[model samples]
Target: MKDSNFLKENNARHMWHPMAHPADSLANPPKIVVGGDGVSIRDIDGKEVLDAVGGLWNVNLGFSCEPIKQAIAAQLDALPYYSTFRGTSNDQVIELSWMLREFFEPDGLTRAFFTSGGSDSVETALRLARQYHKVRGESGRTKYLSLKKGYHGTHFGGASVNGNANFRTQYEPLLPGCFHIPAPYTYRNPFNETDPEKLAQLCATALEDEIAFQGAGTIAAFIMEPVLGAGGVIPPHASFMPMVREICDRNGILLIADEVITAFGRTGDWSGSRHWGVKPDMMSTAKAITNGYFPFGAVMLNDKIADVFEQDTSGRGAIGHGYTYSGHPVGAAAAIACLKETQRLDVAANAGARGAELFAGLNGLAEKHDLIGDVRGGHGLMCALELVSDRAAKTPIDKATIGKIYEATYEAGVMVRVSGPNIIMSPPLILTVEDVQKIVDALDAGFSAA
Candidate 1:
């Protein structure tokens, strides 16, 4: 193992991290996480803190998941890697596909098209969506619609549909014909409505309006996150997704639920689409699919979408998009084990129970801390506290203040993600009630310092 000094130097000098300024590494060095146990991670300085970010919203089973680890090791020894492209298919991936089919069967997703990660999953889904339309003789349907604050992924296709300016601004001119509608955000919205149901109706109306303006025949699909994870853990009303589903059904537009962060019990359900009782035509999943042990993902397709390709005699029906590491054996093995443990433990139930406690605790913090402008979550393990300098004006908290809070919270024994003015938390599903209290208590310490 390299010493701390060497590690720190290389971290600043050689590596560039995602979603961070390259210069920031030298100015404010990134913490070097050396080891993890259960849900707590030990940094290079041997300081341990409960990880509230959950390895970028993927590590649902946490760092020390033995089953996934063993599966990876065993698969490596047997068959380290193999492609799922064309004729060649390995045993692990085959078994994994069968498991996935059964696992996501309730969501009306019967087919699995594997990918390397979230971005790839989304990219594949988008291409397939366009192709699906073309195969169905609707070659003109190439446009996409999504929530204004929703996040898909980093790929050009995903970024085009991505609603956040932070992810889109510098990358434009993105794919043409991609549009966004107002998200069902209760705290701050263009509509100024606070009621969840009402906001949902307005948001759905916005989607309808966009479709009408774009001409429904031109839109291929409406893609969205089930709970809106990266754009700040914004969980929509119960009726929101169902409304969108109905809208899509009526327009003959595919509803592609981007479940990268909300799948595998992150939203207190096996899959986020199932949470709202709406079945999407296609769904993109990753993150917890292998419990973050492997960089793997799958784009799930329903019978409606699959039938178009399966029964197509024309060459256009044949799928053209795929990743080289689509169904890597090692990743497949990890996913297989993860699916077993994920179901056996029924982590969704724990996520729901613990989430209620965390949400209540955060609300308590909101009452005490003037910095917290809004507290969002009641959905599951997904939660966020949007901070503000002044509650009345809802002015976003400064970076320095957020940094202070982050340092203080780490000192108080918790590791939370500070995304702009939002303190986002998507902790492990296995986290207990006691763990929930520690996170809240640590955040309280953070706020108290301010």
Candidate 2:
């Protein structure tokens, strides 16, 4: 490794980070992570801390997931690269599809469309949703509906469906016909509803209103995260998703569960849709699919989608979209190994247990510090603390204030992600009880310093 100053100079000179200003690189150089093991990571300066961000909400199995690492190396040695395109499918992908079908059998997902990552998965699902409608002779159903504060991805389709303006404003003139409804965010809402269940009902009604206003016949699908992730880890009421499912069913609109952050047991269940007891027409999964060992994703489809495409005599059913690395053998091998390890460890159970403890700790911190305006968690390892300048007015905390808390937290011995005014934590599911307490203590320290 190069010296700190050398590495820093080169990074600032060459690197352009995503979701950040290029100029910010020179002023506020990003932390250089040089090593990771177990659930901890060490920066270039050799400052080690418990990782609560979980590698961008992936890496559920932590850094020492040997099975996935070994599988990737073995597959690279056997077949470095093979594209599953145009009548040529790799053995690893084929086996992985079968495993995925069985694993998601409960969610009614019978088919798998592989992608390179979360963005690819979201793009694939959006395209498939429109195609599914077209296959059934409803090509007019091209519009998509989503929840406010929802995040899909960066692709045209995903970006259009994204409800957050941060990802959309700069990239204007995105794909047309994408609509959004109010999310069930109980903390602050236009409806001013504080009760979660009531807010969910109101939000569901907003969906119905949007369907009515847009004419459901023209809407192709509704995409949403079971627990809104990047827009902030906002978990809706227990009744929210099921209500959305029923509404979509009635409107004949496909529901695409964007499980990019909630799949493979991050939400205290095998999948978020399962946690809600509602099966979506299609599900976009990635991140933990390979435990972040490899860039991989899979969009799982139910029989309703599969039957339409399979039964179509016309070539309209033919998928017009795919990635060159759609079914890369290396990615497939890693996913297979990850699935085995994820199931063996039963990560959902650990996520549930640790998640509860973490949520409680955050709430306790809220009591101690006025900085924490809202504490959101409960489903699993995904959690967040929405900070504020004024608790009474709910004024968003300034950037420097949140940055202070972020730096203090890191200094106190935990690395968390700060987005806008929210401190998000999607730690590895393998977190120990002691690790959970440490995270809490670190945050306490962060707040005290702030």
Residue 344 miss distance in model 2 (angstroms): 0.3
Query: Residues 238-334, candidate 1, lDDT per residue (tens digit)?
Result: 9999999999999999999999999999888899999999999999999999989999999999999999999999898877778889999999999
Against the correct fold, how does model 1 do in TM-score? 0.99
Off by over 4 Å in 1: none
C-alpha lDDT (0 to 100) for residue 14 of candidate 2: 82
| Residue 342 displacement (Å), model 2 | 0.2
Query: What's the CA error at residue 226 for candidate 1, in Å?
Result: 1.0
Q: Give the per-residue lDDT of model 2 (tens digit) for 1-450.
A: 789889877886786898898998778889999999999999998999999999899989999999999999999999989878887988899999999999999999999999999999999998888889998999899999998899998988899999889999999999999999999999989999999999999999999999999999999999999999998899999999999999999999999999999999999999999999999999999999999988999999999999999999999998888998999999999999999999999999999999999999999999999989999999899999999999999999999989999999999999999999999999999999999999999999999998
**In model 2, what are the clashing residue pairs, if there are any?**
none
TM per model? 0.99, 0.99
Clashes of 2: 0
TM-score of 2: 0.99
